[model samples]
Target: MSLLQDLFTRPRRNEQMGSSNENRSVLVVGLGRFGTAAARTLGELGEDVLAVDKDPMIIARWAGKVPVMEADLSDPLAVEQINASNFDAALVAIGDSVEASILTTGNLLDAGIPDVWAKSISHQHTRILQRIGASHVFRPETDGGKRVGHLLASRYLDYIEIEGPYSVVKVLTPPAVCGQTIAEADVHGRYGVSVIGVKNPGEEFQYGSNDIVMRHNGEIIILGSQKQIDKFIES
Candidate 1:
């Protein structure tokens, strides 16, 4: 879509989640892929997403999707303007430029925006963000690893652990009784699971080693929740 269309069409992140009982603004520092996606999610969810970036191109890309501006993200002064007590929640999704990202996060915290989520490029980056009072930190690439680990160890990448081992996950094929069709991996009967999708190598990506293209480094995405995933990982 055109830049104009991108601006008007892309929704921001979830504002409802960002605010308390009272409405509040959400600050999204950085307009990269993650920031853009988050901004869209919040905006579409009826939240106010105020995003910032140094590049006008980046700002223009998200023109109307969310309230965006072109400014040096690390500048505390610029951030102070957007991050008054008015911002209930905030996030930093800057990638590659570690120094600028950390500085921006520090500025956000100093501005007293209560809830903050910061993306990290490395453990050190996380440390600094933490020092600056980032409430939540995530390493997207590292998180993708946990997913890959679950998929590689089992035949499913379905559920996340809410509490403990008692997980809720879905399946595509059940566990094999005796190597039946791709659909025959009846994980349900064999392990009391649920099937969601099924695919073959040349067919489609339902959720199976046969269909999943393992990376050269031997990573795969399967289909199962944390409980069933344990079984896959053990083997």
Candidate 2:
């Protein structure tokens, strides 16, 4: 039997392979930087991952971290070798070539992979992947754009998009705002945002206390709309 067939048909003892372990299988097609990160993260999270790449060199880099395979992902026959349905999700992370990305995405969807996520370079590419039944199309550059925005703004130390139009951001308390308690800061009242947590230098995050004074010595994590965050930063 082929490697793919062996992967699927091989029997496992239920007691030896707990139900949680059985449920965490994922297939990641393409081993570019984005793909490699996804595969490694999933493996770290205790998932059984089959990470594929067309380039042997890329596959070699992550061999021990995740189960790596070299395959021509654009070919439908090659895709069919795997029992695609066995995976809880599949990620098509081929970023460079639009054609290769689309073809691999189509093959995975056609082979009945339930959840297929494709990386897209543009809106048009996203639409094509979506039309081919990709469950999700992620623009990796969106985060890069957010990071750039933060860098330009200068007030924020870091920011992450949480959902539509909202983010979790970190910033230092300005000298103007130091010595006041969180309640006095009235972050939500004054800025239309909420302070979620605070972290001092070399310390873990803790829930913001109304009584704890801001010393301008640590970072504050806030959750709010981007507009609200910008307003807070400007103020």
Candidate 3:
């Protein structure tokens, strides 16, 4: 699968539950790392996407791969000219200039877009963006710290947050559970979690197997509430 597809792909349960929501168009301002990733994931999820950046080089890089435009997002007139009504949400991904990020976020809100997400470099910046009508503000550095903490605390190979208090976690089979089949393990009944899939060495995810005995250190993907996941890890 493509990078975007990989990023946006969800577990089967989530796919079924979320099927009712419409695929809304997204406008991502700035072609930086965060912006590009968001745009790619949005596109992979079948949403209409428009990516913008002021730099010509960045625009050239992602031109054919996705719909990209060049503009100084900080300029009110420049932002106002765009057909913002088409987009249901906007992401302010500008990393360097706080001024531009704030201005762009405000402009999007003023244009009648319902949701505006912004990236912030500091706590003060986050407060400023929130004051300017950004519906959501993220601090990448802070979130990165929390992610690393989760890895260390749970020893999970990978983790992704889902809606509410649920998470999907990938963990290697510990020595105690290595020889157990999914049925023998009784993961859901015992731990209040579901084993979504498993991955053996040199193999792709196999989601249909219940009798396959896990080998030592084989990886397993699971979906559960935070409390359930924590209990599973501790056991």
**Best candidate per TM-score, number?**
2
lDDT of 2: 0.79
Give the per-residue lDDT of model 2 (tens digit) for 1-235. 7544655554432323545446456789888889889988987887667899888888788877778888887898887666565566789999889999999889888877778888999989989998888998889897588688776776788878775888888888656557777889887788888878878777777788787666667777889998888787666
Report the candidate with higher lDDT, 1 versus 2: 2
- How high is each candidate's TM-score? 0.61, 0.75, 0.63
For residue 132, model 2's alpha carbon misses the true position, in angstroms, by: 4.1
- Candidate numbers sorted by TM-score from highest down: 2, 3, 1
- Candidate 3 whole-model C-alpha lDDT, 0 to 1: 0.80
Clashes of 3: 0
TM-score of model 2 vs. true structure: 0.75
Worst 10 residues of 3 by lDDT: 6-15
Model 3 agreement with the true structure over 66-175: per-residue lDDT tens digits? 87888886877877656664467789999999888888898888877788899999899999998988989998878788778888887789888765888889988756
